[model samples]
Target: MRFLSKKDVPFKEVVPDGYIDIHSHLLPGIDDGVKTIYQSGYILEQFENFGFKKVITTPHIMQDIWPNSSQTITSNLKKLKDVLVPLGITKIELRASAEYMMDDLFYERIKNNDILPLHQNYILVEMSTFAPPINLNEILFEIKLAGYIPILAHPERYSFYHDDLKKYDELKASGFLFQVNLLSISGYYGEQIKSFAKKMIDQGYIDFTGTDVHNYHQLEVLEKGFEFKIAKKITSLMKNNIEFS
Candidate 1:
């Protein structure tokens, strides 16, 4: 949770333009993201201005907390679009997906084939920062057996894995693609996370990058993140996001 000083560079100068954001919490009032339609619209405008052409908004689908379903996410996205289209905020194509917390509910959903994916075959999943699930590998295997690619969100922020970075390599070997948060490189999450993010980038372990944007303040940090030297280095490594763009 340490905030690093921002480098003096424009965001557009270093970051590639028109990349598709694979993970975000853009739907209003559904989770720990924007609370109102106005907030959602404002952040979407900022994302577009920051060089994102499309945003696949992944709201939290944790059963113990958010408990959002694919239907709820789609309905909320439609409501936001209904307001934004007439207001001329239609430049960025918005889509709905769920960030499935790797918990019991997620396992049940996977078994029932009732989860929402980022694309046709790619699902975004996350674990608790304090500790990983005991059946993490088993769940990942099930996800792949179901014919879906499992993309792990913001692996650098998981403090438990910081001591042993090789855990990242093991997960990658197990077919879990890594998505580092853009702000992690700017030390927005903390110095340790920033260090791990840089290590992942240096080793060419990152398959994608995302804003993981929830509100305006997070967006501000993300704009500053573009000025980080690591941002430019990982620009060519964001193939997973660009392919979907």
Candidate 2:
């Protein structure tokens, strides 16, 4: 018997039944995400093209630059959604959350209950690559005590932990989710980062994968993830609310 052709199958049939993109930057002009509502709409179009079901755009809430609040993110998301409404691009759903920076500002936000957590009470946190925070554990503990699942974003890109991966081990044991950057798997950050990413994957410590799309170049790099083995694994494993679902 002749083999069936891949072209005969519908695109939707091939895609995972449901896609929950946990990390993205679709909010307009908040931190390093999309610059305008037009760009945000563009990203929505891409999500539709990619067969994504639920798109959660995460904006950075950092101290030095993106000192944004939930109100600002909400307003921006509305503008972006309105732009998409005219196109009637209702095939994909959109949500907004913050990629929190682990700094004094994080503590302040937690104390004030000014956080925009992702689904399952998960909060995204990013640390500096060059230096470890003086109060890393304390900050994570505060976030947990505040009732949010802390996720360390792009842990492999942080060089400070090169000598000892134990930092990640400790954080994991302490109950922190780890999100790896897809671009890093493609060596977008560097060879060292790529190595770290591979190590993390091998150890089965990575829980989520994110595009962390800031602009076009990053997206271009991420597009190449389909050819990489680890990337393929991540793409297959990403599911809705897997951490607590």
Which candidate number would show the highest TM-score if scored against the true structure?
Answer: 1
TM-score of each: 0.93, 0.87
Candidate 1, after superposition: displacement of residue 88 in Å?
Answer: 1.3
Cα lDDT tens digits for candidate 2, 1-245: 97643223332332354566777888877787678777677667766776777777789888988888899989988877777879768888888888888889888999788888887688888887778689987887788788888888888888878778787888899888898876677678878888888788888878887767887677655554433334345555565234422
- Residue pairs in collision within model 1: none
The candidate 1 region of ten consecutive residues with least summed lDDT is: 5-14
* Cα-lDDT of candidate 2: 0.75
Candidate that scores best on lDDT: 1
RMSD of each: 3.2, 4.6
Tens-digit lDDT track of model 1 for 21-47: 888898999999999999999988877
Model 2, TM vs. native: 0.87
